[model samples]
Target: MPKSAVVLLNRPSLEAPPHVEGAAEFELLDVDAPHVRVLDLGVTRGDGVFETISFGAGHPQALAAHLARLAKSARALDLPEPDADAWERAVLAAASAIDPAPEAYVKTVMTRGLEGDGRPTGWAYASAAPDHSRARSEGIRVVLLDRGYRHDVAKTSPWLLAGSKTLSYAVNRAVLREAARRDADDVVFVSSDGYLLEGSTSNLLLRFGDTLVTPGLDQGILAGTTQGDLFAFARSQGLETEYARLETRKLAEADAAWLVSSVRHAAPIRRVDGVDRAVDTDFTAAVNSHLIGRTS
Candidate 1:
Protein backbone atom coordinates (compact mmCIF):
# COMPACT_ATOMS: atom_id res chain seq x y z
CA MET A 1 0.00 0.00 0.00
CA PRO A 2 1.13 3.54 -0.63
CA LYS A 3 2.03 5.87 2.20
CA SER A 4 -0.76 8.21 1.11
CA ALA A 5 -4.12 8.04 -0.70
CA VAL A 6 -6.55 10.40 -2.35
CA VAL A 7 -10.30 10.14 -3.02
CA LEU A 8 -11.95 12.63 -5.33
CA LEU A 9 -15.60 13.19 -4.70
CA ASN A 10 -17.85 13.21 -7.76
CA ARG A 11 -20.34 15.39 -6.04
CA PRO A 12 -18.92 17.27 -3.10
CA SER A 13 -22.19 18.97 -2.33
CA LEU A 14 -25.62 17.47 -3.04
CA GLU A 15 -26.82 21.01 -3.57
CA ALA A 16 -24.47 21.27 -6.58
CA PRO A 17 -24.34 19.11 -9.69
CA PRO A 18 -21.95 16.20 -9.92
CA HIS A 19 -18.62 16.52 -11.72
CA VAL A 20 -19.68 13.77 -14.07
CA GLU A 21 -23.10 12.31 -14.85
CA GLY A 22 -23.99 9.05 -13.05
CA ALA A 23 -20.50 8.78 -11.59
CA ALA A 24 -19.62 6.84 -8.45
CA GLU A 25 -19.56 8.74 -5.17
CA PHE A 26 -15.77 9.11 -5.32
CA GLU A 27 -12.69 7.75 -7.07
CA LEU A 28 -9.29 6.90 -5.65
CA LEU A 29 -6.51 8.71 -7.51
CA ASP A 30 -2.74 8.98 -7.61
CA VAL A 31 -1.60 11.12 -4.71
CA ASP A 32 1.33 12.76 -6.50
CA ALA A 33 -0.38 13.74 -9.76
CA PRO A 34 -1.69 17.19 -10.51
CA HIS A 35 -5.44 17.21 -9.87
CA VAL A 36 -6.39 20.88 -9.53
CA ARG A 37 -6.78 23.30 -12.39
CA VAL A 38 -4.59 26.37 -12.68
CA LEU A 39 -7.53 28.74 -12.85
CA ASP A 40 -9.42 27.12 -10.04
CA LEU A 41 -10.70 29.69 -7.59
CA GLY A 42 -9.23 27.68 -4.78
CA VAL A 43 -5.84 28.11 -6.39
CA THR A 44 -6.18 31.61 -7.76
CA ARG A 45 -8.06 33.26 -4.92
CA GLY A 46 -7.72 30.87 -2.01
CA ASP A 47 -11.47 30.45 -1.96
CA GLY A 48 -12.34 27.25 -0.14
CA VAL A 49 -12.63 25.47 3.21
CA PHE A 50 -11.01 22.35 4.64
CA GLU A 51 -10.79 20.05 7.65
CA THR A 52 -7.88 17.86 8.72
CA ILE A 53 -9.06 14.85 10.70
CA SER A 54 -6.57 12.66 12.53
CA PHE A 55 -7.10 8.94 12.81
CA GLY A 56 -5.64 6.48 15.31
CA ALA A 57 -5.63 2.78 14.55
CA GLY A 58 -7.76 3.52 11.46
CA HIS A 59 -10.45 5.23 13.53
CA PRO A 60 -10.88 8.88 12.59
CA GLN A 61 -11.03 11.07 15.69
CA ALA A 62 -13.81 13.64 16.04
CA LEU A 63 -15.26 12.64 12.67
CA ALA A 64 -18.69 14.10 13.32
CA ALA A 65 -17.34 17.33 14.77
CA HIS A 66 -14.91 17.79 11.89
CA LEU A 67 -17.61 17.23 9.29
CA ALA A 68 -19.99 19.55 11.12
CA ARG A 69 -17.34 22.25 11.16
CA LEU A 70 -16.69 21.69 7.45
CA ALA A 71 -20.33 22.35 6.69
CA LYS A 72 -20.33 25.33 8.97
CA SER A 73 -17.30 26.75 7.17
CA ALA A 74 -18.98 26.15 3.83
CA ARG A 75 -22.01 28.06 5.05
CA ALA A 76 -19.75 30.85 6.23
CA LEU A 77 -18.30 31.14 2.72
CA ASP A 78 -21.78 30.95 1.16
CA LEU A 79 -20.61 27.79 -0.62
CA PRO A 80 -22.80 24.77 -1.12
CA GLU A 81 -23.38 22.68 1.96
CA PRO A 82 -20.92 19.77 1.89
CA ASP A 83 -22.68 16.45 1.66
CA ALA A 84 -21.61 15.04 5.02
CA ASP A 85 -22.44 11.44 4.22
CA ALA A 86 -20.41 11.57 1.02
CA TRP A 87 -17.47 13.20 2.81
CA GLU A 88 -17.51 10.65 5.61
CA ARG A 89 -17.34 7.80 3.15
CA ALA A 90 -14.52 9.47 1.25
CA VAL A 91 -12.53 10.13 4.40
CA LEU A 92 -12.82 6.54 5.57
CA ALA A 93 -11.94 5.15 2.15
CA ALA A 94 -8.84 7.31 1.80
CA ALA A 95 -7.71 6.47 5.32
CA SER A 96 -8.13 2.74 4.82
CA ALA A 97 -6.27 2.81 1.52
CA ILE A 98 -3.08 4.01 3.16
CA ASP A 99 -0.70 1.89 5.24
CA PRO A 100 -2.01 1.63 8.80
CA ALA A 101 -0.13 3.57 11.42
CA PRO A 102 -0.51 4.74 14.99
CA GLU A 103 -1.34 8.20 13.70
CA ALA A 104 -2.52 9.55 10.34
CA TYR A 105 -4.62 12.38 8.95
CA VAL A 106 -7.17 12.86 6.19
CA LYS A 107 -7.62 16.34 4.83
CA THR A 108 -11.01 17.07 3.26
CA VAL A 109 -11.23 20.12 1.03
CA MET A 110 -14.06 21.80 -0.90
CA THR A 111 -13.07 24.55 -3.27
CA ARG A 112 -15.07 26.83 -5.52
CA GLY A 113 -14.23 25.47 -8.94
CA LEU A 114 -13.19 27.41 -12.06
CA GLU A 115 -14.53 30.97 -11.82
CA GLY A 116 -17.68 30.24 -13.83
CA ASP A 117 -17.74 26.46 -13.73
CA GLY A 118 -20.10 26.53 -10.73
CA ARG A 119 -19.22 22.93 -9.91
CA PRO A 120 -17.05 22.72 -6.78
CA THR A 121 -13.95 20.56 -6.41
CA GLY A 122 -13.62 18.27 -3.44
CA TRP A 123 -11.16 15.60 -2.35
CA ALA A 124 -9.90 13.69 0.69
CA TYR A 125 -6.18 13.08 1.01
CA ALA A 126 -4.79 10.73 3.61
CA SER A 127 -1.24 10.15 4.80
CA ALA A 128 0.65 8.86 7.80
CA ALA A 129 1.17 11.56 10.41
CA PRO A 130 4.64 12.94 11.07
CA ASP A 131 6.51 11.96 14.21
CA HIS A 132 5.49 14.47 16.86
CA SER A 133 6.98 12.64 19.80
CA ARG A 134 9.61 15.29 20.46
CA ALA A 135 7.13 18.14 20.58
CA ARG A 136 4.67 16.16 22.67
CA SER A 137 7.24 15.10 25.25
CA GLU A 138 9.88 17.82 25.29
CA GLY A 139 7.36 20.60 24.52
CA ILE A 140 7.77 23.58 22.15
CA ARG A 141 8.70 27.23 22.37
CA VAL A 142 6.13 29.75 21.13
CA VAL A 143 6.05 33.48 20.47
CA LEU A 144 3.08 35.81 20.63
CA LEU A 145 2.19 37.77 17.49
CA ASP A 146 -0.46 40.37 16.74
CA ARG A 147 -3.33 39.12 14.56
CA GLY A 148 -4.46 42.63 13.64
CA TYR A 149 -8.05 41.82 14.46
CA ARG A 150 -10.16 42.62 17.45
CA HIS A 151 -11.67 39.93 19.65
CA ASP A 152 -15.10 41.03 18.37
CA VAL A 153 -14.04 40.70 14.71
CA ALA A 154 -16.25 37.67 14.15
CA LYS A 155 -19.31 39.65 15.19
CA THR A 156 -18.30 43.05 13.89
CA SER A 157 -16.96 41.84 10.54
CA PRO A 158 -18.39 38.52 9.57
CA TRP A 159 -17.50 39.27 5.97
CA LEU A 160 -13.84 38.95 6.87
CA LEU A 161 -14.41 35.23 7.40
CA ALA A 162 -13.04 35.42 10.93
CA GLY A 163 -14.27 32.18 12.46
CA SER A 164 -14.36 30.18 9.25
CA LYS A 165 -11.67 27.62 8.36
CA THR A 166 -10.95 28.86 4.88
CA LEU A 167 -8.08 27.85 2.57
CA SER A 168 -6.37 31.22 2.65
CA TYR A 169 -3.51 30.36 4.97
CA ALA A 170 -0.77 32.67 3.76
CA VAL A 171 -0.83 34.54 7.03
CA ASN A 172 -0.91 31.33 9.01
CA ARG A 173 2.19 30.05 7.23
CA ALA A 174 3.86 33.41 7.51
CA VAL A 175 3.53 33.37 11.27
CA LEU A 176 5.47 30.13 11.53
CA ARG A 177 8.35 31.67 9.60
CA GLU A 178 8.17 34.63 11.93
CA ALA A 179 8.29 32.24 14.87
CA ALA A 180 11.38 30.58 13.40
CA ARG A 181 13.07 33.93 13.02
CA ARG A 182 12.27 34.64 16.65
CA ASP A 183 13.87 31.31 17.68
CA ALA A 184 10.54 29.68 18.50
CA ASP A 185 8.79 26.60 17.16
CA ASP A 186 5.25 27.99 17.09
CA VAL A 187 3.06 31.00 17.84
CA VAL A 188 -0.10 32.07 19.63
CA PHE A 189 -1.94 34.93 18.01
CA VAL A 190 -3.19 37.87 20.04
CA SER A 191 -5.94 40.12 18.84
CA SER A 192 -5.09 43.73 18.00
CA ASP A 193 -6.72 44.76 21.26
CA GLY A 194 -4.45 42.55 23.40
CA TYR A 195 -6.82 39.59 23.71
CA LEU A 196 -5.45 36.10 23.14
CA LEU A 197 -6.78 34.31 20.08
CA GLU A 198 -5.33 31.02 18.83
CA GLY A 199 -2.36 29.43 17.11
CA SER A 200 -1.70 29.20 13.38
CA THR A 201 -3.20 25.74 13.04
CA SER A 202 -3.95 24.85 16.63
CA ASN A 203 -5.96 26.12 19.58
CA LEU A 204 -4.54 27.73 22.69
CA LEU A 205 -5.09 25.80 25.92
CA LEU A 206 -3.99 27.22 29.26
CA ARG A 207 -4.04 25.38 32.53
CA PHE A 208 -4.69 27.41 35.65
CA GLY A 209 -4.13 25.16 38.63
CA ASP A 210 -6.95 22.63 38.25
CA THR A 211 -8.83 24.50 35.53
CA LEU A 212 -8.28 24.41 31.77
CA VAL A 213 -9.34 27.49 29.82
CA THR A 214 -9.44 28.20 26.07
CA PRO A 215 -10.36 31.35 24.28
CA GLY A 216 -14.08 31.61 23.60
CA LEU A 217 -15.23 30.78 20.04
CA ASP A 218 -16.61 34.28 19.66
CA GLN A 219 -13.06 35.52 19.30
CA GLY A 220 -12.96 34.67 15.57
CA ILE A 221 -11.00 31.46 15.98
CA LEU A 222 -11.75 28.07 14.54
CA ALA A 223 -13.70 25.88 16.96
CA GLY A 224 -11.11 23.17 17.57
CA THR A 225 -12.56 19.68 17.52
CA THR A 226 -9.46 18.29 19.21
CA GLN A 227 -9.70 20.91 21.94
CA GLY A 228 -13.34 20.03 22.47
CA ASP A 229 -12.44 16.36 22.87
CA LEU A 230 -9.63 17.31 25.24
CA PHE A 231 -12.08 19.34 27.28
CA ALA A 232 -14.23 16.22 27.65
CA PHE A 233 -11.15 14.23 28.60
CA ALA A 234 -10.25 16.85 31.19
CA ARG A 235 -13.74 16.65 32.68
CA SER A 236 -13.46 12.89 32.94
CA GLN A 237 -10.22 13.37 34.87
CA GLY A 238 -11.96 15.79 37.27
CA LEU A 239 -10.32 18.88 35.80
CA GLU A 240 -12.47 21.97 35.33
CA THR A 241 -12.80 23.60 31.90
CA GLU A 242 -13.85 27.02 30.69
CA TYR A 243 -14.13 29.36 27.70
CA ALA A 244 -13.25 32.99 28.28
CA ARG A 245 -11.85 36.14 26.72
CA LEU A 246 -8.26 35.81 27.82
CA GLU A 247 -5.79 38.63 27.90
CA THR A 248 -2.15 38.22 26.85
CA ARG A 249 -1.00 38.29 30.47
CA LYS A 250 -3.17 35.31 31.28
CA LEU A 251 -0.99 33.05 29.09
CA ALA A 252 2.18 34.24 30.79
CA GLU A 253 0.64 33.64 34.19
CA ALA A 254 -0.90 30.23 33.46
CA ASP A 255 0.33 27.18 35.31
CA ALA A 256 0.96 25.50 31.94
CA ALA A 257 0.00 26.00 28.29
CA TRP A 258 -0.27 23.97 25.10
CA LEU A 259 -1.19 24.26 21.45
CA VAL A 260 -3.64 21.48 20.67
CA SER A 261 -4.80 20.31 17.25
CA SER A 262 -5.95 17.15 15.50
CA VAL A 263 -2.62 16.14 13.98
CA ARG A 264 -0.12 17.23 16.63
CA HIS A 265 -2.50 16.36 19.47
CA ALA A 266 -1.10 18.53 22.25
CA ALA A 267 2.25 20.35 22.35
CA PRO A 268 2.97 21.95 25.68
CA ILE A 269 4.45 25.44 25.44
CA ARG A 270 7.82 25.56 27.21
CA ARG A 271 8.74 29.14 26.40
CA VAL A 272 6.97 32.26 25.21
CA ASP A 273 8.68 35.26 23.65
CA GLY A 274 12.10 34.20 24.93
CA VAL A 275 10.82 33.70 28.51
CA ASP A 276 11.06 30.11 29.71
CA ARG A 277 7.89 28.71 31.25
CA ALA A 278 7.37 25.60 33.32
CA VAL A 279 5.97 22.55 31.59
CA ASP A 280 3.62 20.07 33.25
CA THR A 281 5.15 16.90 31.92
CA ASP A 282 2.86 14.55 33.82
CA PHE A 283 -0.36 16.18 32.65
CA THR A 284 0.98 16.60 29.13
CA ALA A 285 1.77 12.91 28.94
CA ALA A 286 -1.71 11.99 30.11
CA VAL A 287 -3.32 14.31 27.56
CA ASN A 288 -1.30 12.87 24.68
CA SER A 289 -1.93 9.31 25.82
CA HIS A 290 -5.67 9.84 25.75
CA LEU A 291 -5.48 11.59 22.38
CA ILE A 292 -3.45 8.84 20.74
CA GLY A 293 -5.61 6.11 22.25
CA ARG A 294 -8.84 7.59 20.99
CA THR A 295 -10.82 5.18 18.80
CA SER A 296 -13.45 7.60 17.61
Candidate 2:
Protein backbone atom coordinates (compact mmCIF):
# COMPACT_ATOMS: atom_id res chain seq x y z
CA MET A 1 0.00 0.00 0.00
CA PRO A 2 1.21 3.50 -0.77
CA LYS A 3 1.60 5.78 2.20
CA SER A 4 -0.62 8.77 1.56
CA ALA A 5 1.55 11.88 1.34
CA VAL A 6 0.30 15.04 3.00
CA VAL A 7 -0.15 17.18 -0.06
CA LEU A 8 -2.02 20.42 0.43
CA LEU A 9 -5.79 19.88 0.49
CA ASN A 10 -6.01 22.13 -2.54
CA ARG A 11 -3.34 20.33 -4.52
CA PRO A 12 -3.94 19.96 -8.25
CA SER A 13 -3.90 16.18 -8.10
CA LEU A 14 -3.10 13.26 -5.83
CA GLU A 15 -2.13 9.67 -6.46
CA ALA A 16 -4.37 7.18 -4.66
CA PRO A 17 -4.45 3.40 -4.52
CA PRO A 18 -6.73 1.21 -6.67
CA HIS A 19 -9.81 1.38 -4.46
CA VAL A 20 -9.56 5.12 -4.00
CA GLU A 21 -8.86 5.67 -7.67
CA GLY A 22 -11.79 3.48 -8.64
CA ALA A 23 -13.99 5.57 -6.38
CA ALA A 24 -12.82 8.84 -7.88
CA GLU A 25 -14.82 8.05 -10.98
CA PHE A 26 -18.24 8.09 -9.28
CA GLU A 27 -19.97 9.89 -12.14
CA LEU A 28 -21.13 6.77 -13.95
CA LEU A 29 -24.31 6.94 -11.91
CA ASP A 30 -26.61 9.82 -12.69
CA VAL A 31 -27.42 11.98 -9.66
CA ASP A 32 -30.10 14.01 -11.40
CA ALA A 33 -33.58 14.78 -10.04
CA PRO A 34 -35.90 12.08 -8.71
CA HIS A 35 -33.69 9.24 -9.96
CA VAL A 36 -33.14 8.15 -6.37
CA ARG A 37 -29.42 7.76 -6.86
CA VAL A 38 -27.38 5.87 -4.30
CA LEU A 39 -24.47 7.96 -3.12
CA ASP A 40 -21.50 6.68 -1.13
CA LEU A 41 -22.93 8.48 1.86
CA GLY A 42 -20.76 6.47 4.24
CA VAL A 43 -17.83 8.70 3.30
CA THR A 44 -19.59 11.53 5.17
CA ARG A 45 -23.05 10.71 6.43
CA GLY A 46 -23.77 7.63 8.52
CA ASP A 47 -26.40 6.53 5.95
CA GLY A 48 -25.00 4.59 2.95
CA VAL A 49 -23.60 1.24 1.87
CA PHE A 50 -20.03 -0.06 1.67
CA GLU A 51 -17.79 -3.14 1.50
CA THR A 52 -14.11 -3.98 2.10
CA ILE A 53 -12.15 -6.63 0.27
CA SER A 54 -8.51 -7.71 0.46
CA PHE A 55 -6.23 -7.20 -2.52
CA GLY A 56 -2.58 -8.16 -2.65
CA ALA A 57 -0.14 -8.41 -5.51
CA GLY A 58 -2.10 -8.70 -8.79
CA HIS A 59 -4.47 -11.30 -7.40
CA PRO A 60 -7.96 -10.76 -6.02
CA GLN A 61 -10.66 -13.43 -5.90
CA ALA A 62 -12.57 -14.29 -9.04
CA LEU A 63 -15.55 -11.97 -9.74
CA ALA A 64 -18.33 -14.45 -8.87
CA ALA A 65 -17.57 -14.74 -5.18
CA HIS A 66 -16.85 -11.07 -4.64
CA LEU A 67 -19.95 -9.99 -6.55
CA ALA A 68 -22.21 -12.43 -4.76
CA ARG A 69 -21.19 -10.99 -1.43
CA LEU A 70 -21.55 -7.46 -2.74
CA ALA A 71 -25.01 -8.21 -4.08
CA LYS A 72 -26.10 -9.78 -0.81
CA SER A 73 -24.87 -6.77 1.12
CA ALA A 74 -26.81 -4.51 -1.25
CA ARG A 75 -30.00 -6.55 -1.11
CA ALA A 76 -29.72 -6.60 2.65
CA LEU A 77 -30.06 -2.83 2.58
CA ASP A 78 -32.56 -2.91 -0.31
CA LEU A 79 -30.14 -0.64 -2.15
CA PRO A 80 -29.61 -0.79 -5.89
CA GLU A 81 -26.61 -2.85 -6.87
CA PRO A 82 -24.57 -1.90 -9.87
CA ASP A 83 -25.56 -3.81 -13.00
CA ALA A 84 -23.39 -6.83 -13.75
CA ASP A 85 -21.52 -4.86 -16.40
CA ALA A 86 -21.11 -1.91 -14.07
CA TRP A 87 -19.97 -4.07 -11.21
CA GLU A 88 -17.48 -5.81 -13.47
CA ARG A 89 -16.27 -2.50 -14.82
CA ALA A 90 -15.75 -1.13 -11.33
CA VAL A 91 -13.96 -4.29 -10.29
CA LEU A 92 -11.68 -4.10 -13.29
CA ALA A 93 -11.03 -0.43 -12.61
CA ALA A 94 -10.17 -1.19 -9.02
CA ALA A 95 -8.16 -4.25 -10.06
CA SER A 96 -6.28 -2.42 -12.75
CA ALA A 97 -5.23 0.24 -10.28
CA ILE A 98 -3.96 -2.41 -7.88
CA ASP A 99 -0.19 -2.88 -7.63
CA PRO A 100 0.28 -6.55 -8.51
CA ALA A 101 2.90 -7.01 -5.81
CA PRO A 102 1.32 -4.91 -3.12
CA GLU A 103 -0.89 -5.84 -0.19
CA ALA A 104 -3.62 -3.25 0.31
CA TYR A 105 -7.12 -2.37 1.52
CA VAL A 106 -10.12 -1.72 -0.75
CA LYS A 107 -13.24 0.04 0.50
CA THR A 108 -16.27 0.65 -1.75
CA VAL A 109 -19.20 2.92 -0.96
CA MET A 110 -22.74 3.43 -2.40
CA THR A 111 -25.03 6.07 -0.98
CA ARG A 112 -28.32 7.78 -1.90
CA GLY A 113 -27.81 10.86 -4.07
CA LEU A 114 -28.53 14.58 -3.96
CA GLU A 115 -31.52 16.75 -5.08
CA GLY A 116 -32.00 19.42 -7.77
CA ASP A 117 -30.87 22.02 -5.26
CA GLY A 118 -27.48 20.31 -5.50
CA ARG A 119 -27.68 19.26 -1.88
CA PRO A 120 -27.85 15.55 -1.00
CA THR A 121 -30.80 14.31 -3.11
CA GLY A 122 -31.31 11.07 -1.29
CA TRP A 123 -29.72 9.11 -4.15
CA ALA A 124 -26.58 6.98 -4.00
CA TYR A 125 -23.20 6.57 -5.73
CA ALA A 126 -20.31 4.27 -4.95
CA SER A 127 -16.52 4.65 -4.73
CA ALA A 128 -13.42 2.71 -3.66
CA ALA A 129 -10.37 3.57 -1.59
CA PRO A 130 -7.32 1.28 -1.24
CA ASP A 131 -4.33 1.82 0.99
CA HIS A 132 -0.84 0.70 1.93
CA SER A 133 -0.67 -2.77 3.57
CA ARG A 134 2.39 -2.88 5.78
CA ALA A 135 0.82 -1.32 8.89
CA ARG A 136 -1.48 -4.32 9.32
CA SER A 137 1.72 -6.35 9.51
CA GLU A 138 3.08 -4.00 12.18
CA GLY A 139 0.07 -3.46 14.50
CA ILE A 140 -1.99 -0.55 15.77
CA ARG A 141 -3.30 0.68 19.13
CA VAL A 142 -6.97 1.41 19.86
CA VAL A 143 -8.85 2.98 22.76
CA LEU A 144 -12.33 1.86 23.69
CA LEU A 145 -15.27 4.27 23.97
CA ASP A 146 -18.84 4.04 25.24
CA ARG A 147 -20.78 5.30 22.23
CA GLY A 148 -23.02 4.05 19.36
CA TYR A 149 -26.50 4.49 17.95
CA ARG A 150 -29.13 2.65 19.95
CA HIS A 151 -31.27 2.13 16.86
CA ASP A 152 -28.31 0.18 15.51
CA VAL A 153 -30.58 -2.82 15.68
CA ALA A 154 -34.31 -2.14 15.62
CA LYS A 155 -35.03 0.97 13.54
CA THR A 156 -32.33 0.32 10.93
CA SER A 157 -32.88 -2.00 8.01
CA PRO A 158 -33.50 -5.62 9.04
CA TRP A 159 -31.05 -7.09 6.56
CA LEU A 160 -28.63 -4.27 7.29
CA LEU A 161 -28.25 -4.63 11.06
CA ALA A 162 -24.56 -4.37 11.91
CA GLY A 163 -24.15 -6.44 8.76
CA SER A 164 -24.80 -4.26 5.70
CA LYS A 165 -21.86 -1.86 6.22
CA THR A 166 -24.07 1.22 5.68
CA LEU A 167 -22.59 4.71 5.69
CA SER A 168 -24.71 6.62 8.17
CA TYR A 169 -21.53 6.60 10.23
CA ALA A 170 -20.96 9.94 11.90
CA VAL A 171 -20.74 8.45 15.37
CA ASN A 172 -18.32 5.68 14.43
CA ARG A 173 -16.12 8.04 12.41
CA ALA A 174 -16.13 10.67 15.13
CA VAL A 175 -15.08 8.11 17.70
CA LEU A 176 -12.22 6.90 15.51
CA ARG A 177 -11.15 10.46 14.76
CA GLU A 178 -11.12 11.15 18.48
CA ALA A 179 -8.94 8.13 19.00
CA ALA A 180 -6.48 9.49 16.47
CA ARG A 181 -6.75 12.81 18.21
CA ARG A 182 -5.67 11.08 21.41
CA ASP A 183 -2.71 9.73 19.49
CA ALA A 184 -4.19 6.26 19.59
CA ASP A 185 -4.15 4.39 16.29
CA ASP A 186 -7.89 3.52 16.27
CA VAL A 187 -11.02 3.00 18.39
CA VAL A 188 -13.03 0.25 20.01
CA PHE A 189 -16.70 0.99 20.67
CA VAL A 190 -18.60 -0.29 23.70
CA SER A 191 -22.35 -0.13 23.99
CA SER A 192 -24.27 1.59 26.79
CA ASP A 193 -25.30 -1.92 27.81
CA GLY A 194 -21.63 -2.65 28.70
CA TYR A 195 -21.09 -5.06 25.82
CA LEU A 196 -18.02 -4.70 23.62
CA LEU A 197 -19.26 -4.10 20.07
CA GLU A 198 -16.36 -3.35 17.74
CA GLY A 199 -13.49 -1.03 16.95
CA SER A 200 -14.29 2.15 15.07
CA THR A 201 -13.75 0.45 11.72
CA SER A 202 -13.09 -3.12 12.81
CA ASN A 203 -14.50 -6.08 14.70
CA LEU A 204 -13.53 -6.88 18.32
CA LEU A 205 -12.28 -10.20 19.64
CA LEU A 206 -10.49 -11.61 22.65
CA ARG A 207 -9.11 -14.95 23.81
CA PHE A 208 -10.20 -16.11 27.25
CA GLY A 209 -7.53 -18.78 27.66
CA ASP A 210 -9.04 -21.64 25.59
CA THR A 211 -12.00 -19.85 24.01
CA LEU A 212 -12.05 -17.15 21.33
CA VAL A 213 -14.75 -14.66 22.39
CA THR A 214 -16.40 -12.09 20.15
CA PRO A 215 -19.63 -10.23 20.75
CA GLY A 216 -22.66 -11.81 19.12
CA LEU A 217 -24.49 -10.01 16.29
CA ASP A 218 -27.34 -9.71 18.78
CA GLN A 219 -24.98 -7.45 20.70
CA GLY A 220 -25.00 -5.25 17.57
CA ILE A 221 -21.64 -6.12 16.05
CA LEU A 222 -20.98 -5.53 12.34
CA ALA A 223 -20.67 -9.27 11.55
CA GLY A 224 -17.13 -8.89 10.27
CA THR A 225 -15.82 -11.08 7.44
CA THR A 226 -12.41 -11.11 9.07
CA GLN A 227 -13.97 -12.06 12.40
CA GLY A 228 -15.74 -14.94 10.67
CA ASP A 229 -12.43 -16.04 9.14
CA LEU A 230 -10.77 -15.86 12.53
CA PHE A 231 -13.50 -18.07 13.96
CA ALA A 232 -12.84 -20.77 11.38
CA PHE A 233 -9.12 -20.39 11.90
CA ALA A 234 -9.52 -20.68 15.66
CA ARG A 235 -11.66 -23.79 15.36
CA SER A 236 -9.11 -25.42 13.06
CA GLN A 237 -6.39 -24.73 15.60
CA GLY A 238 -8.33 -26.58 18.31
CA LEU A 239 -9.37 -23.33 19.92
CA GLU A 240 -12.99 -22.89 20.95
CA THR A 241 -14.80 -19.98 19.34
CA GLU A 242 -17.78 -18.41 21.08
CA TYR A 243 -20.07 -15.51 20.18
CA ALA A 244 -21.57 -14.25 23.39
CA ARG A 245 -22.22 -10.87 24.92
CA LEU A 246 -18.83 -9.50 26.04
CA GLU A 247 -18.30 -7.09 28.88
CA THR A 248 -15.95 -4.26 27.98
CA ARG A 249 -13.85 -5.13 31.02
CA LYS A 250 -13.22 -8.57 29.53
CA LEU A 251 -11.11 -7.02 26.79
CA ALA A 252 -8.52 -5.73 29.28
CA GLU A 253 -8.70 -8.95 31.28
CA ALA A 254 -8.33 -11.31 28.33
CA ASP A 255 -5.07 -13.07 27.57
CA ALA A 256 -4.97 -11.27 24.21
CA ALA A 257 -7.06 -8.87 22.10
CA TRP A 258 -7.48 -7.89 18.48
CA LEU A 259 -9.55 -5.44 16.40
CA VAL A 260 -10.14 -7.21 13.09
CA SER A 261 -11.13 -5.66 9.77
CA SER A 262 -10.09 -5.46 6.13
CA VAL A 263 -8.05 -2.29 6.58
CA ARG A 264 -6.21 -3.30 9.71
CA HIS A 265 -6.55 -7.02 8.96
CA ALA A 266 -5.82 -7.74 12.61
CA ALA A 267 -4.81 -4.87 14.87
CA PRO A 268 -3.24 -5.71 18.19
CA ILE A 269 -4.51 -3.67 21.08
CA ARG A 270 -1.52 -2.06 22.76
CA ARG A 271 -3.40 0.23 25.14
CA VAL A 272 -6.76 0.67 26.87
CA ASP A 273 -8.11 3.45 28.97
CA GLY A 274 -7.65 2.79 32.70
CA VAL A 275 -6.44 -0.74 32.03
CA ASP A 276 -3.25 -2.68 31.30
CA ARG A 277 -2.74 -3.88 27.72
CA ALA A 278 0.17 -6.28 27.87
CA VAL A 279 -1.32 -9.55 26.55
CA ASP A 280 -0.49 -13.01 27.83
CA THR A 281 2.35 -14.73 25.99
CA ASP A 282 0.39 -17.90 25.33
CA PHE A 283 -2.19 -16.10 23.20
CA THR A 284 -0.02 -13.99 20.86
CA ALA A 285 0.41 -16.54 18.07
CA ALA A 286 -3.31 -17.34 17.96
CA VAL A 287 -4.06 -13.65 17.72
CA ASN A 288 -1.68 -13.02 14.81
CA SER A 289 -2.26 -16.12 12.72
CA HIS A 290 -5.88 -15.37 11.77
CA LEU A 291 -5.03 -12.43 9.51
CA ILE A 292 -2.71 -14.43 7.28
CA GLY A 293 -5.30 -15.45 4.70
CA ARG A 294 -4.36 -15.98 1.01
CA THR A 295 -7.67 -16.71 -0.68
CA SER A 296 -11.47 -16.89 -0.73
Name the best candidate (by lDDT).
1
Candidate 1: stretches off by over 4 Å = none
What lDDT does each candidate get? Answer: 0.96, 0.55
- Candidate 1, overall lDDT? 0.96
Model 1: lowest-lDDT 10 consecutive positions = 112-121
Residue 94 displacement in candidate 1 (angstroms): 0.3
Top model by TM-score, which number? 1
TM-score for each model:
0.99, 0.68
Q: Tell me the deviation in Å of residue 177 in model 2.
A: 2.6
